[model samples]
Target: MPQAQKGICAEPNLHALYLMFNVHEDHDEEVRRILAQILNIFDHYDDEHYEAMVSGVIAIGSNYWMELYPGFLPAELAPFPDMHCEDRHAPVVPCDLFIQMRADRADICHAMGTAVYDALKPHVELVEQIKGFRFLDGRDLTGFVDGTENPKGMHKLDVAIIGDEDPEFAGGSYIHIQRYRHNLSKWNQLDVPHQEEIFGRTKTDDIEFASEMKKPFAHTKRTNLKDANGNSIEILRQSMPYGDMKEQGLFFVSCAKSPQPFTKMLESMIFGDAHGNYDKLMDYTTAETGAAFFAPSVDFLKFQGMS
Candidate 1:
Protein backbone atom coordinates (compact mmCIF):
# COMPACT_ATOMS: atom_id res chain seq x y z
CA MET A 1 0.00 0.00 0.00
CA PRO A 2 1.10 3.55 -0.61
CA GLN A 3 1.65 5.91 2.29
CA ALA A 4 -1.86 6.80 3.48
CA GLN A 5 -2.68 10.14 5.04
CA LYS A 6 -1.86 9.95 8.74
CA GLY A 7 -5.21 11.35 9.81
CA ILE A 8 -7.20 8.63 8.05
CA CYS A 9 -6.35 5.96 10.64
CA ALA A 10 -5.00 8.04 13.48
CA GLU A 11 -6.25 7.51 17.02
CA PRO A 12 -8.93 9.78 18.42
CA ASN A 13 -7.63 13.26 19.16
CA LEU A 14 -8.83 15.87 21.61
CA HIS A 15 -9.47 18.53 18.96
CA ALA A 16 -10.35 18.74 15.26
CA LEU A 17 -10.93 21.34 12.55
CA TYR A 18 -12.86 20.56 9.35
CA LEU A 19 -12.98 22.82 6.32
CA MET A 20 -14.85 22.57 3.03
CA PHE A 21 -14.15 24.68 -0.06
CA ASN A 22 -14.98 25.05 -3.74
CA VAL A 23 -12.23 25.96 -6.17
CA HIS A 24 -12.61 29.01 -8.36
CA GLU A 25 -13.10 28.55 -12.09
CA ASP A 26 -9.85 27.99 -14.06
CA HIS A 27 -7.89 27.42 -10.84
CA ASP A 28 -7.87 23.66 -10.47
CA GLU A 29 -4.09 23.32 -10.86
CA GLU A 30 -3.39 26.11 -8.40
CA VAL A 31 -5.76 24.62 -5.85
CA ARG A 32 -4.15 21.21 -6.22
CA ARG A 33 -0.74 22.62 -5.43
CA ILE A 34 -2.19 24.57 -2.53
CA LEU A 35 -3.82 21.45 -1.13
CA ALA A 36 -0.49 19.62 -1.37
CA GLN A 37 1.23 22.41 0.49
CA ILE A 38 -1.43 22.31 3.19
CA LEU A 39 -0.52 18.67 3.80
CA ASN A 40 3.10 19.71 4.16
CA ILE A 41 2.07 22.39 6.65
CA PHE A 42 0.35 19.69 8.69
CA ASP A 43 3.47 17.52 8.64
CA HIS A 44 5.76 20.39 9.60
CA TYR A 45 3.67 21.34 12.60
CA ASP A 46 3.16 17.72 13.62
CA ASP A 47 6.92 17.17 13.65
CA GLU A 48 7.50 20.37 15.63
CA HIS A 49 4.82 19.52 18.16
CA TYR A 50 5.05 15.76 18.33
CA GLU A 51 3.33 15.58 21.68
CA ALA A 52 0.28 17.25 20.21
CA MET A 53 -0.17 14.32 17.81
CA VAL A 54 -1.07 16.57 14.88
CA SER A 55 -2.39 14.85 11.77
CA GLY A 56 -4.41 15.89 8.73
CA VAL A 57 -6.04 14.60 5.54
CA ILE A 58 -6.90 16.49 2.38
CA ALA A 59 -9.57 15.09 0.03
CA ILE A 60 -10.98 15.86 -3.42
CA GLY A 61 -14.68 16.04 -4.01
CA SER A 62 -16.01 13.47 -6.46
CA ASN A 63 -17.50 16.02 -8.83
CA TYR A 64 -14.26 18.04 -8.89
CA TRP A 65 -11.75 15.17 -8.97
CA MET A 66 -11.62 14.86 -12.74
CA GLU A 67 -11.05 18.58 -13.27
CA LEU A 68 -8.13 18.66 -10.83
CA TYR A 69 -6.38 15.39 -11.62
CA PRO A 70 -7.27 14.96 -15.31
CA GLY A 71 -6.44 11.33 -14.60
CA PHE A 72 -8.22 8.20 -13.52
CA LEU A 73 -10.54 8.46 -10.56
CA PRO A 74 -11.03 6.02 -7.70
CA ALA A 75 -13.15 3.13 -8.99
CA GLU A 76 -15.61 3.39 -6.14
CA LEU A 77 -15.72 7.21 -6.01
CA ALA A 78 -19.26 8.56 -6.21
CA PRO A 79 -21.53 11.35 -5.03
CA PHE A 80 -23.51 11.33 -1.77
CA PRO A 81 -26.63 9.21 -1.99
CA ASP A 82 -29.20 11.78 -1.01
CA MET A 83 -32.15 9.89 0.44
CA HIS A 84 -35.28 10.91 2.28
CA CYS A 85 -38.40 9.32 3.69
CA GLU A 86 -41.27 11.29 5.16
CA ASP A 87 -39.66 13.96 7.40
CA ARG A 88 -36.17 12.45 7.56
CA HIS A 89 -33.72 13.71 4.93
CA ALA A 90 -30.14 13.42 3.68
CA PRO A 91 -29.33 16.20 1.28
CA VAL A 92 -26.30 16.92 -0.90
CA VAL A 93 -24.30 20.06 -0.23
CA PRO A 94 -21.12 19.34 -2.14
CA CYS A 95 -17.65 20.85 -1.97
CA ASP A 96 -14.50 20.74 -4.11
CA LEU A 97 -12.13 20.22 -1.24
CA PHE A 98 -12.27 18.86 2.31
CA ILE A 99 -9.47 19.39 4.81
CA GLN A 100 -9.42 17.60 8.14
CA MET A 101 -7.03 18.51 10.92
CA ARG A 102 -6.82 16.81 14.30
CA ALA A 103 -4.55 16.91 17.31
CA ASP A 104 -4.34 16.46 21.04
CA ARG A 105 -4.10 20.26 21.45
CA ALA A 106 -6.66 22.74 20.27
CA ASP A 107 -4.01 25.39 19.65
CA ILE A 108 -2.22 23.12 17.21
CA CYS A 109 -5.43 22.42 15.35
CA HIS A 110 -6.07 26.17 15.17
CA ALA A 111 -2.61 26.91 13.86
CA MET A 112 -2.78 24.25 11.17
CA GLY A 113 -6.30 25.21 10.17
CA THR A 114 -5.18 28.82 9.91
CA ALA A 115 -2.23 27.84 7.78
CA VAL A 116 -4.47 25.92 5.41
CA TYR A 117 -7.05 28.70 5.27
CA ASP A 118 -4.40 31.31 4.53
CA ALA A 119 -2.90 29.25 1.75
CA LEU A 120 -6.09 28.41 -0.11
CA LYS A 121 -8.44 31.35 0.48
CA PRO A 122 -7.28 33.19 -2.63
CA HIS A 123 -8.24 30.33 -4.93
CA VAL A 124 -11.21 28.70 -3.20
CA GLU A 125 -14.51 29.68 -1.66
CA LEU A 126 -14.89 28.52 1.91
CA VAL A 127 -18.11 26.57 2.31
CA GLU A 128 -17.80 25.49 5.94
CA GLN A 129 -15.36 25.55 8.81
CA ILE A 130 -16.24 23.73 12.00
CA LYS A 131 -14.05 23.03 15.00
CA GLY A 132 -14.79 19.97 17.12
CA PHE A 133 -13.52 18.50 20.35
CA ARG A 134 -13.55 15.31 22.35
CA PHE A 135 -16.80 15.30 24.26
CA LEU A 136 -16.98 13.54 27.61
CA ASP A 137 -14.55 10.78 26.68
CA GLY A 138 -15.51 10.27 23.00
CA ARG A 139 -19.24 10.29 23.57
CA ASP A 140 -21.44 12.12 21.09
CA LEU A 141 -23.31 15.21 22.22
CA THR A 142 -26.21 12.76 22.52
CA GLY A 143 -24.65 11.26 25.68
CA PHE A 144 -23.85 7.96 23.99
CA VAL A 145 -20.50 6.53 22.93
CA ASP A 146 -19.82 7.16 19.24
CA GLY A 147 -17.77 4.92 16.95
CA THR A 148 -18.29 2.06 19.37
CA GLU A 149 -18.08 -0.45 16.51
CA ASN A 150 -15.24 1.21 14.60
CA PRO A 151 -12.56 -1.16 13.46
CA LYS A 152 -9.48 -1.17 15.69
CA GLY A 153 -5.69 -1.63 15.35
CA MET A 154 -4.59 -2.81 11.91
CA HIS A 155 -8.14 -3.67 11.09
CA LYS A 156 -8.78 0.01 10.47
CA LEU A 157 -6.44 -0.10 7.48
CA ASP A 158 -8.23 -3.17 6.20
CA VAL A 159 -11.55 -1.43 6.51
CA ALA A 160 -10.67 2.13 5.40
CA ILE A 161 -7.74 2.10 2.96
CA ILE A 162 -8.13 0.86 -0.59
CA GLY A 163 -6.05 -2.19 -1.39
CA ASP A 164 -5.06 -4.35 -4.39
CA GLU A 165 -8.50 -4.21 -5.96
CA ASP A 166 -7.63 -0.64 -6.91
CA PRO A 167 -3.86 -0.79 -6.96
CA GLU A 168 -3.37 2.71 -8.36
CA PHE A 169 -5.44 4.14 -5.56
CA ALA A 170 -4.15 1.85 -2.86
CA GLY A 171 -3.99 3.48 0.58
CA GLY A 172 -6.58 6.04 -0.48
CA SER A 173 -9.94 6.12 1.32
CA TYR A 174 -13.47 6.97 0.26
CA ILE A 175 -15.15 9.50 2.56
CA HIS A 176 -18.76 10.39 3.32
CA ILE A 177 -19.70 13.15 5.72
CA GLN A 178 -22.89 14.56 7.17
CA ARG A 179 -23.59 17.43 9.50
CA TYR A 180 -26.38 16.16 11.78
CA ARG A 181 -28.15 18.76 13.89
CA HIS A 182 -29.80 17.23 16.92
CA ASN A 183 -33.17 18.22 18.33
CA LEU A 184 -32.13 17.98 21.93
CA SER A 185 -35.31 19.59 23.14
CA LYS A 186 -37.40 16.79 21.70
CA TRP A 187 -34.92 14.07 22.53
CA ASN A 188 -34.54 15.19 26.16
CA GLN A 189 -38.28 14.69 26.69
CA LEU A 190 -37.70 10.97 26.47
CA ASP A 191 -36.78 8.99 29.59
CA VAL A 192 -33.52 7.08 29.91
CA PRO A 193 -35.23 3.79 29.17
CA HIS A 194 -36.72 5.14 25.96
CA GLN A 195 -33.37 6.51 24.86
CA GLU A 196 -31.73 3.16 25.54
CA GLU A 197 -34.36 1.38 23.47
CA ILE A 198 -33.72 3.66 20.51
CA PHE A 199 -29.95 3.21 20.73
CA GLY A 200 -30.18 -0.58 21.34
CA ARG A 201 -27.78 -0.43 24.25
CA THR A 202 -27.65 0.16 28.00
CA LYS A 203 -26.84 3.83 28.53
CA THR A 204 -24.71 3.52 31.64
CA ASP A 205 -22.80 0.39 30.67
CA ASP A 206 -22.94 0.66 26.84
CA ILE A 207 -23.98 -2.99 26.55
CA GLU A 208 -25.72 -4.17 23.40
CA PHE A 209 -29.24 -5.55 23.48
CA ALA A 210 -29.52 -9.24 22.81
CA SER A 211 -30.67 -10.20 19.30
CA GLU A 212 -33.98 -11.51 20.64
CA MET A 213 -34.61 -8.25 22.49
CA LYS A 214 -33.36 -5.75 19.86
CA LYS A 215 -35.94 -3.43 18.42
CA PRO A 216 -36.46 -3.38 14.64
CA PHE A 217 -35.86 0.36 14.59
CA ALA A 218 -32.91 0.49 17.01
CA HIS A 219 -29.88 2.43 15.76
CA THR A 220 -27.48 -0.49 16.12
CA LYS A 221 -29.83 -2.81 14.31
CA ARG A 222 -30.11 -0.42 11.41
CA THR A 223 -26.42 0.45 10.99
CA ASN A 224 -24.67 -2.74 12.03
CA LEU A 225 -24.99 -4.33 8.61
CA LYS A 226 -24.16 -7.69 7.13
CA ASP A 227 -23.16 -8.82 3.65
CA ALA A 228 -24.84 -11.50 1.57
CA ASN A 229 -22.29 -13.99 2.95
CA GLY A 230 -23.29 -13.12 6.53
CA ASN A 231 -20.08 -11.23 7.24
CA SER A 232 -20.16 -7.88 9.02
CA ILE A 233 -19.68 -4.80 6.86
CA GLU A 234 -17.67 -2.00 8.50
CA ILE A 235 -16.63 1.59 8.04
CA LEU A 236 -13.93 3.40 9.96
CA ARG A 237 -15.50 6.35 11.76
CA GLN A 238 -13.67 9.58 12.57
CA SER A 239 -16.70 11.58 13.60
CA MET A 240 -16.82 14.29 16.29
CA PRO A 241 -19.46 16.52 17.82
CA TYR A 242 -19.48 20.27 17.20
CA GLY A 243 -21.48 23.49 17.82
CA ASP A 244 -22.32 25.72 20.79
CA MET A 245 -25.11 26.47 23.27
CA LYS A 246 -27.33 27.77 20.51
CA GLU A 247 -26.95 24.54 18.47
CA GLN A 248 -24.90 21.35 18.50
CA GLY A 249 -24.63 18.04 16.66
CA LEU A 250 -22.26 15.41 15.29
CA PHE A 251 -19.90 16.07 12.39
CA PHE A 252 -20.23 12.56 11.05
CA VAL A 253 -17.29 11.07 9.09
CA SER A 254 -17.14 7.59 7.66
CA CYS A 255 -14.13 6.28 5.69
CA ALA A 256 -13.93 3.02 3.85
CA LYS A 257 -12.16 1.26 1.00
CA SER A 258 -15.40 1.54 -0.98
CA PRO A 259 -18.37 3.89 -0.75
CA GLN A 260 -21.01 1.14 -0.73
CA PRO A 261 -21.00 0.51 3.00
CA PHE A 262 -21.67 4.15 3.84
CA THR A 263 -24.51 4.32 1.33
CA LYS A 264 -26.08 1.09 2.53
CA MET A 265 -25.92 2.14 6.17
CA LEU A 266 -27.41 5.53 5.33
CA GLU A 267 -30.23 4.01 3.32
CA SER A 268 -31.01 1.63 6.13
CA MET A 269 -31.20 4.58 8.51
CA ILE A 270 -33.57 6.68 6.40
CA PHE A 271 -35.39 4.30 4.03
CA GLY A 272 -35.29 1.32 6.41
CA ASP A 273 -35.76 -2.32 5.42
CA ALA A 274 -38.63 -4.02 3.63
CA HIS A 275 -40.73 -3.54 6.76
CA GLY A 276 -40.08 0.23 6.61
CA ASN A 277 -38.71 0.25 10.14
CA TYR A 278 -36.26 3.13 10.14
CA ASP A 279 -33.55 3.92 12.62
CA LYS A 280 -35.23 5.49 15.65
CA LEU A 281 -32.26 7.80 16.21
CA MET A 282 -33.05 9.54 12.91
CA ASP A 283 -36.20 10.93 14.50
CA TYR A 284 -34.08 13.18 16.74
CA THR A 285 -31.30 14.15 14.35
CA THR A 286 -31.48 16.04 11.05
CA ALA A 287 -28.71 15.52 8.51
CA GLU A 288 -28.28 19.03 7.22
CA THR A 289 -25.30 18.51 4.93
CA GLY A 290 -23.87 15.55 3.04
CA ALA A 291 -21.03 15.01 0.52
CA ALA A 292 -18.52 12.49 -0.82
CA PHE A 293 -14.75 12.73 -1.29
CA PHE A 294 -11.70 10.56 -1.78
CA ALA A 295 -8.56 11.20 0.22
CA PRO A 296 -5.77 9.85 -1.94
CA SER A 297 -2.59 8.41 -0.54
CA VAL A 298 0.00 10.93 0.61
CA ASP A 299 2.11 9.76 -2.30
CA PHE A 300 -0.55 11.03 -4.73
CA LEU A 301 -0.44 14.50 -3.20
CA LYS A 302 3.32 14.50 -3.15
CA PHE A 303 3.51 13.62 -6.85
CA GLN A 304 0.20 14.16 -8.65
CA GLY A 305 -1.00 17.09 -6.54
CA MET A 306 2.20 18.96 -7.40
CA SER A 307 2.20 18.03 -11.07
Candidate 2:
Protein backbone atom coordinates (compact mmCIF):
# COMPACT_ATOMS: atom_id res chain seq x y z
CA MET A 1 0.00 0.00 0.00
CA PRO A 2 1.26 3.47 -0.84
CA GLN A 3 1.80 5.92 1.97
CA ALA A 4 -0.64 8.78 2.00
CA GLN A 5 -0.29 12.25 3.48
CA LYS A 6 -0.76 12.38 7.27
CA GLY A 7 -3.61 14.84 7.71
CA ILE A 8 -5.71 13.70 4.76
CA CYS A 9 -7.72 11.20 6.77
CA ALA A 10 -7.08 12.30 10.33
CA GLU A 11 -9.52 14.31 12.40
CA PRO A 12 -8.85 18.03 12.22
CA ASN A 13 -8.31 20.18 15.29
CA LEU A 14 -9.47 23.63 16.42
CA HIS A 15 -7.61 25.77 13.94
CA ALA A 16 -6.36 25.78 10.32
CA LEU A 17 -4.79 28.10 7.77
CA TYR A 18 -5.29 27.53 4.05
CA LEU A 19 -3.08 29.45 1.65
CA MET A 20 -3.31 29.48 -2.14
CA PHE A 21 -0.72 31.03 -4.44
CA ASN A 22 0.17 31.54 -8.06
CA VAL A 23 3.81 31.08 -9.01
CA HIS A 24 5.35 33.84 -11.08
CA GLU A 25 6.47 32.78 -14.54
CA ASP A 26 9.85 34.45 -14.23
CA HIS A 27 10.45 32.99 -10.78
CA ASP A 28 9.97 29.29 -11.50
CA GLU A 29 13.41 28.36 -10.21
CA GLU A 30 12.95 30.50 -7.14
CA VAL A 31 9.56 28.93 -6.43
CA ARG A 32 11.02 25.43 -6.61
CA ARG A 33 13.78 26.39 -4.22
CA ILE A 34 11.33 27.95 -1.80
CA LEU A 35 9.09 24.90 -1.98
CA ALA A 36 12.05 22.74 -1.08
CA GLN A 37 12.85 25.01 1.84
CA ILE A 38 9.23 24.92 3.01
CA LEU A 39 9.11 21.15 2.72
CA ASN A 40 12.33 20.87 4.69
CA ILE A 41 10.86 23.03 7.42
CA PHE A 42 7.74 20.88 7.53
CA ASP A 43 9.73 17.65 7.64
CA HIS A 44 11.95 18.99 10.40
CA TYR A 45 8.88 19.81 12.48
CA ASP A 46 6.89 16.72 11.49
CA ASP A 47 6.36 15.44 15.01
CA GLU A 48 4.15 17.19 17.65
CA HIS A 49 4.17 20.91 16.98
CA TYR A 50 1.63 21.17 14.15
CA GLU A 51 0.57 19.31 11.05
CA ALA A 52 1.17 20.79 7.63
CA MET A 53 0.60 19.56 4.07
CA VAL A 54 1.44 21.01 0.67
CA SER A 55 0.18 20.28 -2.83
CA GLY A 56 0.11 21.81 -6.26
CA VAL A 57 -1.60 21.46 -9.61
CA ILE A 58 -0.84 23.02 -12.94
CA ALA A 59 -3.34 25.64 -13.93
CA ILE A 60 -5.46 24.81 -16.91
CA GLY A 61 -3.92 26.17 -20.13
CA SER A 62 -0.54 26.13 -18.37
CA ASN A 63 1.66 23.04 -18.59
CA TYR A 64 4.86 24.59 -17.33
CA TRP A 65 5.05 22.43 -14.24
CA MET A 66 3.16 19.43 -15.63
CA GLU A 67 5.76 19.09 -18.35
CA LEU A 68 8.38 18.18 -15.75
CA TYR A 69 6.61 14.97 -14.74
CA PRO A 70 5.44 13.21 -17.83
CA GLY A 71 2.29 11.10 -17.33
CA PHE A 72 2.31 11.74 -13.57
CA LEU A 73 -0.93 13.73 -13.47
CA PRO A 74 -3.91 12.28 -11.67
CA ALA A 75 -6.25 10.61 -14.15
CA GLU A 76 -9.06 12.97 -13.22
CA LEU A 77 -6.92 16.05 -12.50
CA ALA A 78 -8.02 19.19 -14.27
CA PRO A 79 -9.01 22.76 -13.66
CA PHE A 80 -12.22 23.44 -11.78
CA PRO A 81 -14.97 24.04 -14.29
CA ASP A 82 -17.49 26.82 -13.80
CA MET A 83 -20.97 25.83 -12.60
CA HIS A 84 -24.03 27.81 -13.55
CA CYS A 85 -27.80 27.51 -13.20
CA GLU A 86 -30.35 30.28 -13.43
CA ASP A 87 -29.02 33.17 -11.32
CA ARG A 88 -26.31 31.17 -9.52
CA HIS A 89 -22.77 30.84 -10.86
CA ALA A 90 -19.76 29.11 -9.31
CA PRO A 91 -16.67 30.54 -10.92
CA VAL A 92 -13.46 28.61 -11.53
CA VAL A 93 -10.35 30.28 -10.17
CA PRO A 94 -7.13 28.33 -10.64
CA CYS A 95 -4.13 28.41 -8.33
CA ASP A 96 -0.80 26.63 -8.73
CA LEU A 97 -0.08 25.83 -5.09
CA PHE A 98 -1.99 25.05 -1.89
CA ILE A 99 -0.66 24.97 1.66
CA GLN A 100 -2.72 23.65 4.55
CA MET A 101 -1.69 24.09 8.17
CA ARG A 102 -3.68 22.77 11.12
CA ALA A 103 -3.12 22.53 14.83
CA ASP A 104 -4.73 22.63 18.22
CA ARG A 105 -4.03 26.34 18.59
CA ALA A 106 -4.39 29.30 16.30
CA ASP A 107 -1.00 30.69 17.25
CA ILE A 108 0.79 27.60 15.99
CA CYS A 109 -1.06 27.67 12.71
CA HIS A 110 -0.32 31.36 12.31
CA ALA A 111 3.41 30.91 12.96
CA MET A 112 3.69 28.17 10.34
CA GLY A 113 1.68 30.18 7.83
CA THR A 114 4.00 33.12 8.34
CA ALA A 115 7.07 30.96 7.74
CA VAL A 116 5.63 29.63 4.47
CA TYR A 117 4.76 33.09 3.20
CA ASP A 118 8.15 34.50 4.12
CA ALA A 119 9.93 31.83 2.09
CA LEU A 120 7.76 32.20 -1.02
CA LYS A 121 7.12 35.91 -0.89
CA PRO A 122 9.31 36.78 -3.85
CA HIS A 123 8.35 33.85 -6.04
CA VAL A 124 4.57 33.65 -5.75
CA GLU A 125 1.55 35.85 -5.36
CA LEU A 126 -1.06 35.10 -2.73
CA VAL A 127 -4.46 34.17 -4.10
CA GLU A 128 -6.44 33.48 -0.95
CA GLN A 129 -5.81 32.95 2.73
CA ILE A 130 -8.53 31.54 4.95
CA LYS A 131 -8.42 30.75 8.63
CA GLY A 132 -10.81 27.88 9.42
CA PHE A 133 -12.05 26.74 12.79
CA ARG A 134 -14.20 24.07 14.33
CA PHE A 135 -17.37 25.89 15.09
CA LEU A 136 -19.74 25.01 17.93
CA ASP A 137 -20.28 21.23 17.69
CA GLY A 138 -18.62 21.18 14.26
CA ARG A 139 -21.60 22.87 12.65
CA ASP A 140 -21.26 25.19 9.68
CA LEU A 141 -22.03 28.87 9.81
CA THR A 142 -25.65 28.01 9.05
CA GLY A 143 -25.91 25.71 12.11
CA PHE A 144 -26.03 22.49 10.07
CA VAL A 145 -23.60 19.82 11.23
CA ASP A 146 -20.93 19.58 8.58
CA GLY A 147 -19.44 16.33 7.27
CA THR A 148 -21.87 14.13 9.16
CA GLU A 149 -21.75 11.53 6.38
CA ASN A 150 -17.95 11.36 6.09
CA PRO A 151 -16.39 7.93 5.82
CA LYS A 152 -14.56 6.72 8.92
CA GLY A 153 -11.32 4.86 9.83
CA MET A 154 -9.78 2.85 7.01
CA HIS A 155 -12.86 3.61 4.93
CA LYS A 156 -11.62 7.18 4.75
CA LEU A 157 -8.27 6.08 3.33
CA ASP A 158 -10.02 3.73 0.92
CA VAL A 159 -12.15 6.60 -0.32
CA ALA A 160 -9.36 9.18 -0.47
CA ILE A 161 -6.08 7.63 -1.66
CA ILE A 162 -5.30 6.53 -5.15
CA GLY A 163 -4.59 2.80 -5.45
CA ASP A 164 -3.36 0.49 -8.23
CA GLU A 165 -5.61 2.21 -10.72
CA ASP A 166 -3.11 5.04 -11.10
CA PRO A 167 0.24 3.47 -10.34
CA GLU A 168 2.38 6.55 -10.73
CA PHE A 169 0.14 8.58 -8.45
CA ALA A 170 -0.92 5.75 -6.18
CA GLY A 171 -0.23 7.58 -2.96
CA GLY A 172 -1.60 10.89 -4.07
CA SER A 173 -5.16 12.21 -3.86
CA TYR A 174 -7.17 14.61 -5.96
CA ILE A 175 -8.57 17.56 -4.06
CA HIS A 176 -11.11 20.30 -4.68
CA ILE A 177 -11.38 23.46 -2.59
CA GLN A 178 -14.06 26.12 -2.57
CA ARG A 179 -14.58 29.27 -0.54
CA TYR A 180 -18.25 29.97 0.15
CA ARG A 181 -19.72 33.09 1.71
CA HIS A 182 -23.05 32.78 3.43
CA ASN A 183 -25.87 35.26 3.63
CA LEU A 184 -26.24 34.82 7.38
CA SER A 185 -28.81 37.57 7.88
CA LYS A 186 -31.19 35.82 5.52
CA TRP A 187 -30.33 32.36 6.80
CA ASN A 188 -30.94 33.33 10.41
CA GLN A 189 -34.41 34.67 9.56
CA LEU A 190 -35.81 31.21 8.68
CA ASP A 191 -37.77 29.32 11.34
CA VAL A 192 -36.26 26.23 12.97
CA PRO A 193 -38.33 23.53 11.25
CA HIS A 194 -37.99 25.24 7.92
CA GLN A 195 -34.23 25.39 8.34
CA GLU A 196 -34.25 21.68 9.08
CA GLU A 197 -36.27 21.05 5.96
CA ILE A 198 -33.75 22.92 3.81
CA PHE A 199 -30.90 20.85 5.24
CA GLY A 200 -32.77 17.52 5.38
CA ARG A 201 -31.69 17.17 8.98
CA THR A 202 -32.90 18.10 12.45
CA LYS A 203 -31.38 21.33 13.76
CA THR A 204 -30.84 20.47 17.40
CA ASP A 205 -30.19 16.74 17.06
CA ASP A 206 -28.38 16.54 13.71
CA ILE A 207 -30.59 13.59 12.69
CA GLU A 208 -30.96 13.01 9.00
CA PHE A 209 -34.39 12.98 7.44
CA ALA A 210 -35.71 9.72 6.10
CA SER A 211 -36.20 9.27 2.36
CA GLU A 212 -39.90 10.00 2.51
CA MET A 213 -39.31 13.16 4.51
CA LYS A 214 -36.58 14.58 2.22
CA LYS A 215 -37.33 17.35 -0.21
CA PRO A 216 -36.22 17.08 -3.85
CA PHE A 217 -34.06 20.18 -3.63
CA ALA A 218 -32.68 19.56 -0.16
CA HIS A 219 -28.89 19.70 0.06
CA THR A 220 -28.70 16.17 1.42
CA LYS A 221 -30.75 14.80 -1.45
CA ARG A 222 -28.76 16.64 -4.10
CA THR A 223 -25.31 15.56 -2.87
CA ASN A 224 -26.02 11.88 -2.33
CA LEU A 225 -24.49 10.30 -5.44
CA LYS A 226 -24.15 6.64 -6.31
CA ASP A 227 -22.60 4.54 -9.00
CA ALA A 228 -24.35 2.28 -11.53
CA ASN A 229 -23.98 -0.66 -9.13
CA GLY A 230 -25.67 1.43 -6.41
CA ASN A 231 -22.60 1.85 -4.24
CA SER A 232 -22.38 5.25 -2.62
CA ILE A 233 -19.40 7.20 -3.97
CA GLU A 234 -17.73 8.94 -1.06
CA ILE A 235 -15.12 11.62 -0.49
CA LEU A 236 -13.08 12.49 2.60
CA ARG A 237 -14.08 16.01 3.59
CA GLN A 238 -11.84 18.35 5.65
CA SER A 239 -14.28 21.23 5.58
CA MET A 240 -14.43 23.91 8.30
CA PRO A 241 -16.36 27.06 9.05
CA TYR A 242 -14.59 30.43 8.77
CA GLY A 243 -15.85 33.95 9.27
CA ASP A 244 -16.00 37.09 11.34
CA MET A 245 -18.77 39.44 12.44
CA LYS A 246 -18.69 41.10 9.04
CA GLU A 247 -18.26 38.09 6.67
CA GLN A 248 -18.10 34.32 7.16
CA GLY A 249 -18.79 30.95 5.59
CA LEU A 250 -17.23 27.55 4.85
CA PHE A 251 -13.83 26.57 3.51
CA PHE A 252 -14.86 23.42 1.69
CA VAL A 253 -12.07 20.85 1.26
CA SER A 254 -12.65 17.45 -0.27
CA CYS A 255 -10.19 14.66 -1.15
CA ALA A 256 -10.86 11.55 -3.18
CA LYS A 257 -9.11 8.89 -5.25
CA SER A 258 -10.63 10.57 -8.24
CA PRO A 259 -12.29 13.97 -8.77
CA GLN A 260 -15.48 12.42 -10.09
CA PRO A 261 -17.24 12.22 -6.72
CA PHE A 262 -16.74 15.89 -5.89
CA THR A 263 -17.53 17.06 -9.42
CA LYS A 264 -20.68 14.95 -9.67
CA MET A 265 -21.90 16.13 -6.29
CA LEU A 266 -21.16 19.74 -7.16
CA GLU A 267 -22.92 19.53 -10.54
CA SER A 268 -25.91 17.88 -8.98
CA MET A 269 -26.09 20.62 -6.37
CA ILE A 270 -25.86 23.38 -8.94
CA PHE A 271 -27.72 21.94 -11.97
CA GLY A 272 -30.14 19.69 -10.11
CA ASP A 273 -31.84 16.55 -11.47
CA ALA A 274 -34.34 16.09 -14.28
CA HIS A 275 -36.84 17.83 -12.00
CA GLY A 276 -35.06 21.19 -12.55
CA ASN A 277 -34.21 22.20 -9.00
CA TYR A 278 -30.84 22.89 -7.42
CA ASP A 279 -29.63 22.60 -3.83
CA LYS A 280 -31.72 24.87 -1.61
CA LEU A 281 -28.62 25.89 0.33
CA MET A 282 -27.32 27.67 -2.75
CA ASP A 283 -29.83 30.40 -2.07
CA TYR A 284 -28.11 31.19 1.25
CA THR A 285 -24.47 30.81 0.16
CA THR A 286 -22.32 31.82 -2.78
CA ALA A 287 -19.17 30.02 -3.95
CA GLU A 288 -16.61 32.75 -4.49
CA THR A 289 -13.69 30.60 -5.70
CA GLY A 290 -12.94 27.08 -6.86
CA ALA A 291 -9.64 25.25 -7.45
CA ALA A 292 -8.34 21.72 -7.93
CA PHE A 293 -5.04 20.29 -6.58
CA PHE A 294 -3.14 17.01 -6.31
CA ALA A 295 -1.46 16.12 -3.04
CA PRO A 296 1.36 13.70 -3.75
CA SER A 297 3.17 11.39 -1.38
CA VAL A 298 6.09 12.55 0.77
CA ASP A 299 8.46 10.32 -1.15
CA PHE A 300 7.47 12.00 -4.38
CA LEU A 301 7.95 15.42 -2.85
CA LYS A 302 11.52 14.60 -1.87
CA PHE A 303 12.40 13.66 -5.45
CA GLN A 304 10.84 16.69 -7.18
CA GLY A 305 14.31 18.31 -7.63
CA MET A 306 13.76 20.28 -4.41
CA SER A 307 17.09 19.17 -2.99
The top-ranked prediction according to lDDT is 1
Across 245-278, the per-residue lDDT of candidate 1 in tens digits comes to 8999999999999999999999999999899999
Top TM-score: which candidate number? 1
User: RMSD of each candidate?
Assistant: 0.8, 2.8
Computed on alpha carbons, the lDDT of every model, listed in order, comes to: 0.92, 0.78
> How many Å off is the CA of 71 in candidate 2?
5.5
User: Which runs of model 2 end up more than 4 angstroms from their true locations?
Assistant: 48-71
Q: Which ten residues in a row have the lowest lDDT in candidate 2?
A: 54-63
Candidate 2 local distance difference test against the native: 0.78
As for candidate 1, its clashing pairs are none
